[model samples]
Target: SIEIGENEESAMCIGVAILDDLSYPIAAISLSAPEQRQSDELIESAGIALMAAGRKISEQMATG
Candidate 1:
């Protein structure tokens, strides 16, 4: 998901959910930046990276 100008500081954010082995939502990971430094392309890139990281974490949790 993406959020822009929706909070008190009006920051921009990208996020993804972390799922457990059963595919249940267990947590989330996000990145936030000031509006001036955030763009659609940046958000898209960050979202992809965050999703990858979330998957890694989920895998680790499932193993341990």
Candidate 2:
């Protein structure tokens, strides 16, 4: 889930759940940014980047 900070204007976070071969939880990737510098576009971009990073990590964990 992506959520805003409690202050609403302090931060933004996007998290991807990492899973094992059985699809059980293993770890996670969280990208956070200061809300002041995070516009809607920026947040969306960050989310995309986070997803890409998460994919890379999963691939490494699976094959390496």
Tens digits of per-residue lDDT, candidate 2, 4-26, equal 98645678788887766666769
Model 2 sits at a Cα RMSD from the real structure of: 2.0
**TM-scores across all candidates?**
0.84, 0.77
Residue-level lDDT tens digits of model 1 in 37-60: 876787788888898999999999
Q: Point to the candidate with the largest lDDT.
A: 1
RMSD of each: 1.3, 2.0
- Looking at model 2, residue 13 earns an lDDT score of 80
Cα distance off (Å), candidate 2, residue 39: 0.9
Model 2 error, position 27 (Å): 0.5
Query: Residue pairs in steric clash, candidate 1?
Result: none
Backbone clash pairs in model 2 (N, Cα, C under 3 Å; residues 3+ apart or in different chains), count: 0
Judged by whole-model lDDT over C-alpha atoms, candidate 1 comes out at 0.84
In candidate 2 the C-alpha lDDT for residue 16 amounts to 88
Worst 10-residue lDDT window for candidate 2 reads: 16-25
